[model samples]
Target: MARVNELKRQLKPGQVYRREDLTPYSNAVDRHLAQLVRDGTLQKLAQGLYYFPKKTAFGTPPPNDETLVRSFLKDKRFLLTSPNSYNTLGVGTTQLYNKRVVYNLKRHEEVTLNGKTFFFHKTPYFPKKATPEFLLVDLVNNLDSLAEEREQILKNILAKAKTMNLAKLEHAVDEYGHSKTKKLFRPVLAEMKKTRHAQ
Candidate 1:
């Protein structure tokens, strides 16, 4: 297990490792992994993926749902998104309401991480690249399509654009989505681009 300790030492907190990844380091892979788990050095996040058990300076274990989602994905085509669904639900920017869901445009089921559950929703670009802001607008679009309070949520996001960064927020609507998305996300996206966003 000298090799296992070496491998473990080489990995960072949020990085993921699989059984196959250890073949180069050791011949008896399964036993070494089991020993690490038994020693409390490694934690299995899922069937095949394992991570160091320590928390980063940001204050959490390997990851929450969002961070894990990024590791699980092959590239940028898909993003973990429940915000679009939440936005669609018309929760708006109501104070004292800190409900967060987990899910993405293409994914159907929900995944849980660190005792927190998240829900994924459907989007046109399912199985495709989903930049962060595009995910935001798609989520806002979802809120716009579903809830009775769509406009208010749109306004809330628009009003908070400066805090979230106008350029990046507009990029979500511009880079990955369509003109319709721009029309839908215009109020918020435009307002964010300006110093003071208003009607």
Candidate 2:
């Protein structure tokens, strides 16, 4: 029980933890972890992941997306973005998506932790955070999966591009945009250049 208390002291509410994190406290860490879950000190999110519940007015709050994801991936090198973010690009995407998309170097499968769904895609590269530029490139890259009208979104995005951070947008395309997105954006960038030269 002393070891359990010591482990509990090490945990922060709303933070996710892995089994290996507790091994330093006791050799029988698994049994202590199971007991902690039974006693409400920790909530098991998955086979190897657990979270200390944060009590609130409503109930125990779930772990933040970053917390859960970092624990699940066992690394900090992943991007957490949602399809819903596409709606913010003024690209005529109005449908709200009820899922999260994770671009990571590993773990290419859908995961459910603490009642939230996370779709993990194995990608060679992704930015640490979602910049407006990166989001735009990503939206175009995954247009087919979104519920909005594709051609209309494309049109609006191109029209709005004239007012965006052109350099950053182009850089994002060069770095993260897939072949299809690059092909689609090439003419738009050219048109923007023509308009600039005309002015």
Candidate 3:
């Protein structure tokens, strides 16, 4: 009991922890974890994942998506994004999606952590954060998977692209665009350049 109390003292609220992380603090790590869960000191997010929820006026908020994924992956290099973010580009993507997408180097499977669905995509590279340029490129990369009309969205995307920083958009295309996405953007970029030079 004294050792368990000692272990509990090490936990910080609003943080996620893996069973292995708690092991060094307790000789009977599994037993202490079970006790903590039973006493509401920790919430089991998954088989080995736990969260010490922070209290708020409304209620205890769920763990931050980034924190949850970081604990689960044991890596901080990942991009958390959703199709819904594309709507902010003003390219007519208004359909709300229930899915959350995580682009990382480690996993490629659908997982549910603490009632939220996450699609873990293993990719060669991804930005540390999702910028507008990255989101635009990503929108095209995952176009087929989205519920929006692809043709209309593509047209709107090109129109929207014209209004953004040409260099950043081109860089995002080169760095993150898939083969088809590259093919789609090449001519549009060329045309934009020609128009700019003509002006």
Candidate 4:
């Protein structure tokens, strides 16, 4: 359990981790992995990623994959800016609303761990990939005002929209069209809707 303890000792909120991170402490992985899940010592966000279990006011309910991933990826390269939030908000959005997370990663791989899955989208094509760390940094740089840079964010998103899966994008906007968040996308979404209609 030393490895698990090391992970418990090191990981902070908002950071995403991989198994290679814990390689030095491999001996304790299996026993502790099973034990952690069993006794609530850890919440596995994916095959190699985990987080300290949450203690909610409701006396500790099971955390979803998103929550676990967010808490574990503490202020690092991987941020929790993904469709997880949209999924949690409801079964509506321009994403799969999939139970797992979808991140814009510097790499590409699919991981299934502790019953949770994560898909890492490559970095080269995303113009407005909003991994929360990058988003927060950009937000901070721009007067800490999300409003000040609203147009830029919207435009960047549309520019990169072509890179995403077209069908899923349509389903998301169609299902969640009435949300106020749509207001941010009104201009681009309108244009997209027009183009979609013409086709």
Candidate 5:
């Protein structure tokens, strides 16, 4: 009991923890974990992941998505995004997606943590955050998976692209665009350049 209390003291509210993190605090780690979970002091998010919910006026809210993911991947270098973000670009994407996408150097699998779906995609490169330019390129890269009219979205994306900074958009395309995305944007960019020269 004394050891369990010691372990409980180590936990901070609203923080995610791995099993190994609590091991050193308790002699009987598994037993203490079971006790803590049964008593609602800790919520087991996944196989080895746990979250200490922070109390609030509304109630105990779930752990932050970034905190949950950072602990799960054990890496800080990742970008969290979703298809729903495409709606912000005004490219006619209106569908609300339940799953979140995580672009990271490690892990490529779909995982459900605390009832939320996360699609972890392995990529060699990704921006630290989802910039508007990156989102546009990402929308095209994942176009096939989105629940929208492909042709209409493509047409709208091209029109939307014309209004953005051509240089930054082109840089995003060169860095993050898939082969098909690059191929699609090439002619559009060339035309924009020609128009600028004509003016």
Candidate 6:
């Protein structure tokens, strides 16, 4: 149909869409979407969620987590992070985690999209990007849930904290960190001050 053609033309590969996005093309947009999915022009990720996959020599590229979550949330007010990011801190957390975590004011449950699981947590505050300071605070905040030795994790994080920007780290600890995280950072920061005074 003409409506289908118009809708298809507007869609770009690797972009996700909702039924409402295509509603402007036709009144029976759902029926058209069903047909498109059947014909391989589109792939259904979940209820009312669709993706126009980008084809490569190997196969269709998987949807980006940001795009998928953004589409699902219908808003950009979310932070995408994972436990595996802890590995990047050189804080002795080398274990790879298969799950992704989204920190947002909305959506406090796990959601699966296209066979990938995303754990959403409702938080009042989080940074736009995962900085080293933020990650350190986050690691300690969720330390109990991590699959690493608790004491060793804390020791390594404290050691790593010494090498980071003290001012920014302190600011992050005050802003995004919980009471427990602040308590833990107290002695480490004290040692930093001692080291600074010695210099």
Residue-level lDDT tens digits of model 1 in 1-199: 5788776766676666666666677667788888887887777776555767557576555555555655554233455444433433333533332234433444666655444555544454542445445556665555543534656666665554446666777666665455666786676555555655443
TM-score of 1: 0.52
Q: What TM-score would candidate 2 get against the native?
A: 0.92
What is the alpha-carbon lDDT for the whole of candidate 1? 0.57
C-alpha lDDT of candidate 2 relative to the true structure: 0.87
Candidate 1, which ten residues in sequence have the lowest lDDT sum? 89-98
Report model 4's TM-score to 2 decimal places.
0.38
What's the residue-level lDDT of 178 in candidate 4?
A: 35
Please give the RMSD to the true structure for each candidate, in Å.
Answer: 7.0, 1.7, 1.1, 13.4, 1.2, 1.5
Residue 191 of model 5, lDDT score: 87
Per-residue lDDT for 109-184 in model 3, tens only?
9999999999999997799889999999999999998889889999999988888888888999999999999999
Residue-wise C-alpha lDDT for candidate 2, range 21-92, written one tens digit per residue: 889987689999999999989999988899998899999878899999999899898999899887788878
Error of 2 at 139 (Å): 1.1
**lDDT of each model, Cα atoms only?**
0.57, 0.87, 0.93, 0.48, 0.94, 0.91
lDDT of 5 by residue, 1-199 (tens): 9998999999999999999999999999999999999999999999989999999999999998999999999999999999999999999999998889999999999999888999999998799989899999999999998789999999999999998888989999999999999999999889888888999
The better candidate by lDDT, 2 or 6, is: 6
Candidate 1 error regions (>4 Å): 1-3, 6-9, 55-67, 74-92, 95-109, 114-136, 144-148, 154-174, 177-199
List TM-scores for all candidates, in order. Answer: 0.52, 0.92, 0.96, 0.38, 0.96, 0.93
Could you tell me the lDDT of residue 79 within candidate 3? Answer: 93
Worst 10 residues of 2 by lDDT: 157-166
Worst 10 residues of 3 by lDDT: 159-168
Please report how far candidate 4 places residue 180 from its true position, in Å.
Answer: 28
Q: Candidate 5: lDDT over CA atoms?
A: 0.94
